[model samples]
Target: MKKLFSCILCLSLMVCIPVYAQDVDYSDEDYWYATCSKVQTSQEGVKACVGFQNYLDDQFNKLKEEMESYKNDLGSLQLNSSRIEELAKKQKTLSDSLDSQVKNMENQIVEINKEIEAVKVEIEEKQKEIDKWSDQISTRMINEQAGTGTNILIDLIMGSSSLNEMFRRFSGIERITASDQEQIEQLSDLKKELELKKDEQERLSDQIEEQKERIEEEKAFAQELQASYDQLAEEYRKVEADLKQKLQEQAAASNNIPSAGVISPSVEVTVPSVSGFINPVPGAYRSAGTWAYPGGGMHLGEDMAASIGTPVIAPADGVIIYASNPAPTNGGYLGNWTGWPYGGGNTIEMLCNVNGTLYAISFAHLAQEGFGVSAGQVVSQGQYLAAVGNSGNSSGAHCHIEVINLGSMSMETAISRFAASADFAFGAGWNTTATACEAGASAPCRERPERFF
Candidate 1:
């Protein structure tokens, strides 16, 4: 029995310990070695295991502290939830701004193209006009020169028909020459202006390109930052998982040590369900009184509230043991079913042996028919046994359950000798009805919840 208890406790402890790796201060090398290298045999082994377990816990706590500090730093920098939200808002604003900029740039490009096209058309028209004017001027100059030779140029310029006619012709020629020169100059200036306009359009295009590059850089940087945040979150999760596993393991190891068995005479006992079980009331409650004294400060069996006359079912397969009327001794008024000190009023008990372990299932706050089935009646899991009622000293309608563990001796004697086991299984002021029956005396609690068929 001691060996069995030790093995079960060890397994449970292992399951409870956590395993993690963080920035741990392992400066006490001697302690670590001593804690880790201790062999199992006596109480020293148990102590060493507990010390190691505590060390692991301390390491995890340190890691948690580091993570908290990191979280604070992340807060200082715009990196947490609020920061992400702000960044998202900023990103949206930037996106909208970029969208507007792109549209404006596109519109500008279109307008620039139109302006360039207009300039090209104007340049073409100017070129044609310049060519026509040049041809006309050349023709007039040539004809004049042909008509009046170099020697006649001075005479023709000074004299021609009457004075008024000569003046008019001279002015006409001067006006035409001046007008042609002016046209030529204007056409040259227009061409130079067109070239400058083309240069301005190119510069506008460069600006658009620069804006695009800036947007891309911002997007890439945002992605990198998000990736880093994801990595940090993942690392935190891994560390937490390791820490939990190590804690479970340490707990398992600590509980591996067995209690010294107390010798006692065996009695005719009935065991309960091995695996499948459920709450008879299907709700929560608190115990208001004890068997000895009805009114009590400390709670007894756990109680669960239900509607008046709610059907109470058996949690597991067992034989009806005891079904009794509510006694005045049981405390009636209690808090909500969820609260502590579960109360049981009228009680019905069932006894069954599971994997060599004997257990009793007590149903409290039963209606008029305490046990629907008689004693020695076989019950299946979730079988309706009776309707719940406020028959006992219960404030409301609720069911009280008790799981009694009969050790090698009676509860009365076991408490005096193997108090440790008694305390573990059935201590005072407890509603122990919520018990997970074991397959054997040494089996772990892994009961399937009861279900109505």
Candidate 2:
């Protein structure tokens, strides 16, 4: 369970899927290839090259900013011990951002691969042309040194009998000599041009290779940061209440928080209810684990992943305890913590009675202005709640649902308790020891929603 929780926390990195790799015309491979291959050639190609390099520079600059931000985040938390989990989350977010930049660089390498290969072929052809020109020049020089053309000219001049014929022969010989010299000059110029192209190709290819190596190094660094973070923290070390407070603080720091009790328009959708509870997201199949498996991640709730605007409904008969829309539906980004409890965008906290047992259920990352019900509202099983949103700390559109067993706790008691202290997941989620609900345990126990679903 600890390992699973770790994996879940890592998902926080993926929450803000992309801080956009800019979409510019210059990002094309031809432009990237021209950036180097035409260094000594056309002005237009040089411009294109500059644009491509500038694109790369911009991405790298963004990465640098993220790194700086990470440093600042760490510095702020250095004096605080209770906020280690938050610090760890910040570290992971920055690490993921860095890793994402590295991938962008690698993608550039891939995009320019064809162009680079074509340049290599051009270099080889230029070298061949240079070789041919050199061979022609060498032959001409050797002939001149041996007086081969000079003897021909002399023979032609001496063999002429009539003065008119002799003049004609001299004219022909002069013409032939001038033509040979002109050919050599032209070939020499061509050879220099080919050599320039070859040099440019070599230079640019080397630069590209260096860029690739640097990206690999950056990738390694991101991995190292992830490893260090994993050791420093294990998902959530603090209690749910503390974590909730931290999220609230983070939102407050922004100063642009969405006010609570913001009612949304009514939504019409069918919800699938089986016995006491219904699928919160009718068509979306929910993940039933604490965190993502196969690789390390951290997730506290069952995620019902779907496209934006997908209807989110109540899992069972419940009363809305607390509801708020704090962030926009499309406002989610990496490292953003705006929301009621840090990334729990447009949250709806409710305590429901499934059969005879009381359970506290929460829905997070809901669409903006899509709240069909509000605080203290009486909602039935499979009632329209909200829509899936790509809200705070979300990688995509999904509703994160958490269910607490609440043992024998009364619905009224659970609601009042939560109202007093906005502790999510019914008192800090699963225990580090046992996953299943302990038999004869006290009321207000956290239960795995997967079992109920």
Residue-pair clashes per prediction, in order, are 46, 14
Indicate which candidate wins on TM-score.
Answer: 2
Model 2 lDDT tens row, 1-453:
224323533443232211222454754554454444344454344344545666766766776676666656655654244465456556656665665656655665664565667767877787787668656655654455354333444556576567876666566545545646665556555555555555555556765686787787677667666665544433332343345555555545665344455222232222222357767787887643553321334455677778889988777876777788868886654345567666676788776776667777888888987678787677878778888886775545677887767766765566556655555655543323233364334555555566766
Candidate 2: where is the Cα deviation over 4 Å? 1-97, 124-193, 231-236, 243-273, 276-336, 346-361, 365-399, 404-447
138, model 1: CA deviation in Å?
Answer: 99
lDDT of 1 by residue, 8-115 (tens): 334533322223323444456445433333222333333443455456446435544544554455456532433433333333333333344345434544554555
Where model 1 places Cα greater than 4 Å from the true spot, the runs are 1-273, 283-296, 326-345, 369-371, 407-453
Q: What's the TM-score of every candidate structure?
A: 0.27, 0.50
lDDT of 1 at 249: 44
- Scored against the true structure, residue 117 in model 2 reaches a CA lDDT of 71
